[model samples]
Target chain A: METVMLDTGISERGDMQKSRVKVGIKKLDLFYSDFQALKDVNMDIEEKKVTALIGPSGCGKSTFLRCINRMNDLIPGCKVTGDILIDGTDIYKENIDVAYLRKEVGMVFQKPNPFELSVFDNIAYGPRTHGLRDKKKLEIIVERSLRHAALWDEVKDRLNKTAMGLSGGQQQRLCIARVLAVEPSIVLMDEPTSALDPISTGKIEDLIAALKNDYTIIIVTHNMQQAARVSDYTAFFLLGDMIEMGPTTRVFQLPGDKRTEDYITGRFG
Target chain B: MTANDRWSSKEMILQYRARQKRRQAIAYAFMYLAAAFAVATMLAIIGFIFTKGISEISWEFLTSDVHDAGREGGILPIIINTLYLVGLGLLFAAPLSVLAAIYMTEYSKQGILIKIIRYFTSNLAGIPSIIFGLFGFMFFAKILGWSWSLLSGSATIAIVILPTLIRTSEEAILTVPAGYKEGSLALGATKWQTMVKVVIPTASPGIINGIILGMGRIVGETAALVFTLGSGTDIASSLMSSARSLSLHLFILANEGISTSKAYATATVLIVIVLILNLIAGWFGKRINRYKDAR
Candidate 1:
């Protein structure tokens, strides 16, 4: 029973201190012009758990996750139908403020999307936009966010420097802290460590586990081992359909669907 | 392995080698001849202008007023008039062109009409300056009832340079990265805020280059001003009154047959002003290019 809360002693890490809202998609379908990207995806992302969306390339996992935060709205031809609710409130409501919705549902893109700003400015940007204008308050938020992402010790002294001056892994973590500064309930990471070296990738993986305590974490990754290492639950997608969804231990060891089994075993994406 | 195969075909190979050498010599000779002709033509023109013009140029010539009667005569009044036109012309043209360019690059949707309009603006660069002068005379001087005054001439010159300024500024604004705008807007800043804060500042170098180049054309222009600015070298108080520009003075003194010496003096002064304008433009162009290319 202790193993339920501990993934090799990971619960000692305080992985769920604040993130407790119900998160998921219900019968979600998406299309780009005439081409359908996702079809009827119904899954529940457990509160305060790191859920991994695993699939081959073009499997629509990224599309489904983007729909949650409405990042897909930026694309002119993309259309989303069905419900993506955070805390049981349909976010796509007519009067829902897209700007305010973005603040609640923070995102980290595939690439490190740190602005062409200094390291401090990058983290300070989100809080400033939310109207945290006091210089001392901005300083404190930047410190905490960077520390949460485990980057403050190395970057604190040189926070005045450009974000682009950082290494690739560092930049990705900087982006994560940037999103975290606004204090959102849910964090969507789309292949966040896909571009990092092994050591940097390990650091980000640990940070993701550490972050689940304060925020709901949903990561879209192609690495099967990554899905097993960091997540409590895993959803397997193939060619735009949710093939299987279950506890991480159960999904990889005993997949309910043939496609999930094949994907986990590297028989197909 | 055989000697004949090792050595290859001697007669045919020799003939081909000879032909290749002849072709190379012909190409090199043609390139040098063309270069020589270009340098010679340029030097010849400059030499002819300076031979008659430079001797007539003096400080007194630039400081005095024009006279067909018992009055002081100097090229200074005309010199001042030329500078006035270029300054006033650019003041009107630069902002108007920048706004027009921003509309084309930022607001317009790139339909058939937009494409046609872009094409027409570029084609204006190919139009003769004389035609621009005619429009200036007919529109500003005649229709606007301003007479052959500084206002009409300068306004006409401004119209002549508008297309150039717009095209250059359009190119500058269009080259701004989509990432800059997106990054700013995603932070809750409005679209206009992003443009004013990040986009326009970054593209400023290109816009400045356009304005400088457009002003150069205004400084050197003569055909357009002759019909619009009048043939007298008298300084005026207001844009509503007739005044003589340097280009117009040069033409009149050179053609009047009574004072061709003063004409040469005025022509030399005009060239110096043009050179100054061109140098400033070149310097500005270099700075803008550096800003755009910075990492």
Candidate 2:
């Protein structure tokens, strides 16, 4: 199988060598029973940068995002082939602990899914699951994570209250905080702002911009403008195929493929 | 044509509305009558039992041991035996049922074997209690040689309620939102950790409801206990010692024509215990809903 290297001149710019490949996918194929959801996809995600996967519904962009953390393993009769390497280590290989991999690759779902626990416990859940027991240590971690997700001030006083009582946006940020408590190196967001209002979405986009300085972030979005605003590199997928991927500016301003240009310029999805 | 001509006149619309209201009134009356009849029957039973037995209940009557085969003294020994039997039965059945339900719902694949297991579990619940009694007598009492003791009776009651417990528990577990499990799993929690931390806590109210229902069955159970548990009026000293449950005492008193009042009193006590369990289940259910609705 041919490995499609979509590398561009952007990687050759000054200080580019410092930005290493955080994830490398080669000839990846995914199927749910008979239906292929992702086909021969390949990309190298950079460290400490935001990579946005933008496509219309049923375009396999979300499928590709889930593939990064192997979340597709939960689905019945799902199959995967080829490799998904994080930091040059093949995550698909046998003996790789999925729990540990997920600890390194935390995910925030589209809908706000806070557990039926207090705000503090919700953020502390990941650390506790990983065997953090000291109360003071958990308190510190929870506060730091909530601060990182930009939800600290709103929920600081109500940390002992049930997380379900928080507003939709607060709940989403709390989920992000929960993931951050695990201290993952990579953060996967599956349309994190799709369910939020404009203001909440703006807050999340700002947080993403701030987050990329520390963690490798991969986000899937349907909004084209959002892709342009937050992502450093943009990958457009259609019908299980990655049609084009490059620097976000180049992909939006001067797309190489006609399909990419058509999709980005408001042609039929 | 004008819009006024196309629509019904005000008088005509009023007439149609009146006719619809009359029809709805008739339907509502019938539905209300059906509900009233169900409540009336339940109240009638409780009224009769309390009226007949309330005068018989007193400190002396409740505290004294059974004398002259349940005709002359309080049912203290029988009450103790009832508690012991039901408690022991629940201890044996509840954890096992919950574990089985979790395995069936969370771990097992939806396949032919699981389908068969579910089929048998549901069918087992519908089986007559008398059949269970016969099985208990044969298996626990005779074959196992734990004959006619509280141990045998409690074990029999456990089997009798196991199917009900497992079915309700499985249904409760199924009602947990899929997102909770997914969220937990995405956080690097293992499947078992997700189940323990997220799934079980969310489903606990439903599980408690199932257990309470099982407790009612065990408390009211008489036919099954009769064959496995001997009708001894004395308080049981050990697992091997023969004992009599409240339902069994009620059965013997009424059946043998020894004391109808005593039987009514025993029935009253059993009803009160079941009522308490039901109230607890309701409280837990409401608390869970309130927590959910807080959002």
Top DockQ: which candidate number?
2
Error in Å for residue B287 of model 2:
3.2
lDDT per residue (tens digit) for residues B1-295 in model 2: 9876777788999999999999999999999999999999999999999999988998988899999998899989988998899899999999999999999998999899899999999999999998999999999999999999999999999999999999988987888888789899999999999999999898888888888888889888999988999988899999999999988889999999999998888888888988998898788778767755653
Clashes counted in candidate 1 amount to: 9
Docking class of 1: incorrect
Tens digits of per-residue lDDT for model 1, A1-269: 01122253323224445445477578988999999999999987767788999999999999888787777777778988888778888888888887677777778877665665689988887777666889998999999999999999989889998776788889889988988888887888899889889999899999998998878889999888888889887899888899888778777776898778777887765
Per-residue alpha-carbon lDDT of candidate 1 for residues B1-62, written as tens digits (9 for 90 to 100): 77857766788799999999999999999999999999999788767777887877677766
Instruction: Give the worst 10-residue stretch by lDDT in candidate 2 chain A.
Output: A1-10
Q: Report lDDT (Cα) of residue B28, candidate 2.
A: 100
**How does model 1 score on DockQ?**
0.22
Flag clash pairs in model 1: A15-A212, A15-A213, A16-A213, A17-A213, B61-B75, B62-B76, B64-B74, B65-B73, B65-B74
Q: Each prediction's DockQ?
A: 0.22, 0.72
Please state how well chain A of candidate 2 matches the true chain A, as a TM-score.
0.95
